[model samples]
Target: MLKTQFPLASIFFTFSLAAFSSPANARSIAIDEATRLPLVKRAQVWAQPTWIDNTFNFDDLFNPATAPLGSPDEQVLTKGTIDCTYLYEAPNGPVGANPKFKCKTTAQPSLKLKVKYGTENGEVRGEVLGTRLLWALGFFADRNFFLKTTNCFGCSENPVNQKQTDPNSATTPVSFSPSSIERKLAGSEVLKLVPQADGTTKVSQGWGFEELQMVDAPEQLRDREALKLLAVFINHLDNRKANQRLVCLDGSSPQGCTGQTVMMIHDVGSTFGG
Candidate 1:
């Protein structure tokens, strides 16, 4: 119960696979404006499923917390106060942090604060646990940490758009109680082709993005497919583009240098127990 499902409209993506090409070659992608989804030709389902890479590492995330706890004024890492006035973009929407705040520190140049309250208390835990699981599985998930905080700098500021976010709305807020503060990571995982069961062959890559009206380079479709599985495992029900990003695979693909694109899972707060 960690996600909020997007509208179940039939407006999902479709693929145009009339022609075939090598797994590494760039291809064309089309979209249906009515559906707002892409058109891609899917590969025939394989019984053996030779698309996934078996190699993965989880040493950094699984480790126990050892850093000493401190308050925001004292610069304690385990916990701290967020200067919300340094606000970036508080959409005043329920898509994410009620009022996402910016944090500027020497070690963490671009950290953000996300608060969870009432029934959404599990959001913090879901985010923490989901990060570990996705990172281990070798899919793209950004860095986020769950922490407790009582201070919110901009807790009572008047909102910019009173209609999008009513002053008395339960979901929109300038400040929150001891909340779930999530620190944005410096960077995250990349998408690339994995060696097939044969050990050296490339099976699948790339997907068509209808929103862009262009089919991009090939990516081991398994990587994105695996994300679907990871979401299920973490109980992430809201896997919409609102929580995802099409990021560059960073030099990790078979080419050993950055060029192609991959679907990056940027938000996992919708996992765990939303």
Candidate 2:
């Protein structure tokens, strides 16, 4: 009889091997001409998986809501006012269908807010649950929370519809009003930024799935394969670069990170429900 005390280990190893053993299923990754060079260069650093120490404390997995991240009480503190400015990037051309904006508050100075109205609110719930699970599993996930109701201080009158109508429009002067807002709080998921030709820096971008093939480090091969299985287990349908980020844990621009490179799941809203 073939058996072992660690069934989970057996299962994990089996899945990873089945998925990664063959090159027959491999396919070419789509390249973004604008970001190709930058992304390729970045792959040397960001493609490294965030690994736990060989002697890492196993208890941390069960206590994800606590320190090095936050406490359980802090996770539930979701309702608050956020001052925001509209972002011009939209899927519907000129204006956005699902309004997104940059936000700030007294405590959390920087956040990216994605508001989904009507029947799409499930995404918010999925994000909260998905990230919680991923975090507990020791994956790098954004410190995010979901709000049932909040005061969006600088949103337009009808942010979703109105913002899509006029390209030159801007949010009215900052004001507070209670709204049934579904927004994510991106507190510490700072992404690596690449320098632009105009002296500005843009958030480092590329799909997480693409890196599954690109990660060449022998030490990280198992973890990299496991992440592929994890995505399928979570039903993560949206595998775009925008939903995930390659971050520098230590160091600065150009040189990027001198210590650790973290591949973070920036948004898991499309997961579980996918």
Candidate number achieving the greatest TM-score relative to the actual structure: 2
What is the TM-score (0 to 1) of candidate 1? 0.45
The sequence of per-residue lDDT tens digits that candidate 1 reaches over residues 198-251 is 767432222222322232334333333444544565676766544654444333
- Name the regions of candidate 1 deviating beyond 4 angstroms: 1-120, 157-178, 183-224, 249-260
lDDT of each: 0.38, 0.45
After superposition of all CA atoms, the RMSD between model 1 and the true structure is: 16.0
Off by over 4 Å in 2: 1-76, 79-96, 99-102, 106-119, 163-204, 208-210, 213-217
The ten-residue window of minimal lDDT in model 2 covers 21-30
Error of 1 at 146 (Å): 1.2
TM-score of 2: 0.54
Cα lDDT over the full model 1: 0.38
Alpha-carbon error at 222 in model 1, in Å? 4.4
Evaluated with lDDT, which candidate comes out highest?
Answer: 2
